[model samples]
Target: MYKKILLIMLCFLAAMACSSPSNPDNTNNGDIVNGGGSGNGGGSGNTGDGGSTGDGGNTDIPWTEIAPPLPVLDEEAIKYGIDISQEDSVIKEQIRTKIQQYNKDKGGYKVIFIGTPKSEYTQQSSLAKLVIDIAEELYKYKKYKYRNRY
Candidate 1:
C-alpha cells in the first residue's frame, strides 16, 4: 500500500510538473522546455542566448522529428515500477507541435523555455529516492528562482 501510494504521488507530481498551466496567459510566457537526464555531457544543457522567449536559451526552431524508440528499462527503474518508456518522447513531441501551432495561431513568439537549475544531477540509491530528490530540486529551483549561472 505504501509503494502504491508513492507511485500515485509520483505520477501526480510528474504530471503536474510537465503540464502547462491552465491559464495560457499566465505571467510566464509560453515556453516549451526540455530537460535531459544526466548523461555524457558536462554542462547544464543551457544554450544561454537570453532571447527573452524564456526557453532556456532555445530559439524558435521546433525540435527535430524523432521516431519512438524502444523502451530501455533498467533494473533500478523497473524495480521501482516506473514506466520508463519511449512513449513519453512521442507525447512530448505532440505537445511541442501543439505549442508551436498555438504560437503561430496567436501571431506571437509565445513559446519559450524556462531554464532549469544548473546544479549537478546526482543519483540516489533507489529510483524512488532519486525521484523524490528530483522533485525537491525542482521545488527549490522554482522557490529560489534559480538561473544558469554558467
Candidate 2:
C-alpha cells in the first residue's frame, strides 16, 4: 500500500511540474493580449519597456502614484543646546514619547530637525523648549497639531 501511495504521489508531482506556466519569466499580466500579437502566440517575450505583450492587442493595466510619507524630527544631535549630561531621565522620556506619538500619527518618511544658529543659543535650553521648537517647525509644514500638551 505504501509503495502504491508513493507511486501516486510521484505521478501527481510530475503532473504539477508539467502544468506550470508556459512562460515563467513573464510576470506582467497587464500586457497580455487575447489572441497574441504578430502571430507569435499569447504572451511571448518582454516588450522592452519592462512590460510584457499579450496575443491580440495591448491591455496594459493603469497604475496610480503612491503618496509620500511624512517627516519626523531627528534625535541625532543637541540642536537646541540641551545639555544631555545635566538633563533628567523623566524629562527625556516625556520628550521621546511626544516625538514618537507625532511620528506615529504622521507617517515618518525622513529625519528632520529644527536648526538653531550658534549665536542664538547662548545658554543651555530645556527639553520642553526643544519640543516646542520642533512643534513650531512642523507646524510650518502643516504636519503638527497642538493638543495643549506635548
Candidate 3:
C-alpha cells in the first residue's frame, strides 16, 4: 500500500515537474518542433522553476526614516495603532526611558519601534534580523509606514 502511494506521489510530482508554463516569448521547457531532415530541436528550454521569486520580492522597510520609538503606551498605541507587547516590563520601562532620552536629545522624531524586546537579543539574534523579516512581511502587505514620508 505504501509502495503504491509512493509511486502515485512520484508520478504526480514527475508530471508536475515536467509541466511548465510557456514564457511570454512563446517558449516552454517541454518540447520542440521537429521539422523535416533528421531534425534536432531549436529554442532554449526553461529549466528554471518558472523563475520563482518566492518570498524574496518583499521590500524592506526604510528604517533610516523611522520615527523615534514612542516611549509611553499612549504614544505607542496612537502612533503605531497597535497594542505593544514586551516580554519584560522592567526592561520595557528602561527601553521607554532610553527612547525618551534619545528623542529628547534628537529634539524628537518619529521612529517605528518593532515591539520586540532588545534585551533578549544575542549577537546571533539581533533586532535588525528580527525587524527585517517582520518589516518585509508588513511592507509586502502595505501595512508598514514611514512617518517622514507622510
Provide the lDDT at 148 for model 3. Answer: 43
**Residue-wise lDDT of candidate 2 within 80-113, one digit each (tens)?**
2233343344334445555666567666622233
Pairs in clash, predicted candidate 1: 30-112, 31-112, 54-113, 55-112, 55-113, 56-113
User: Better model by TM-score, 2 or 3?
Assistant: 2
* lDDT of candidates 1 onward, in order: 0.42, 0.47, 0.45
How many clashing pairs does model 1 include?
6
* Error of model 3, residue 30, in angstroms: 81
What ranking emerges by lDDT with the best candidate at the front? 2, 3, 1
Q: lDDT tens string, model 3, 89-137?
A: 3334434444445456565633345453333455444544444444455
**Where does the lowest 10-residue lDDT sum fall in candidate 1?**
109-118
Question: RMSD for each model, in Å, please?
Answer: 26.8, 16.0, 16.1
Instruction: Judge candidate 2 against the unseen true structure and give its global Cα lDDT, from 0 to 1.
Output: 0.47
Model 1, range 1-150, lDDT digits (tens) per residue? 999999999999999978956554332232323332223243233222334454445464554332224453554223322232323343334334444454456654222222222233224433334344445654577467755542
> Could you estimate the TM-score for every candidate?
0.18, 0.21, 0.21
Shift in Å, residue 118, candidate 2: 93
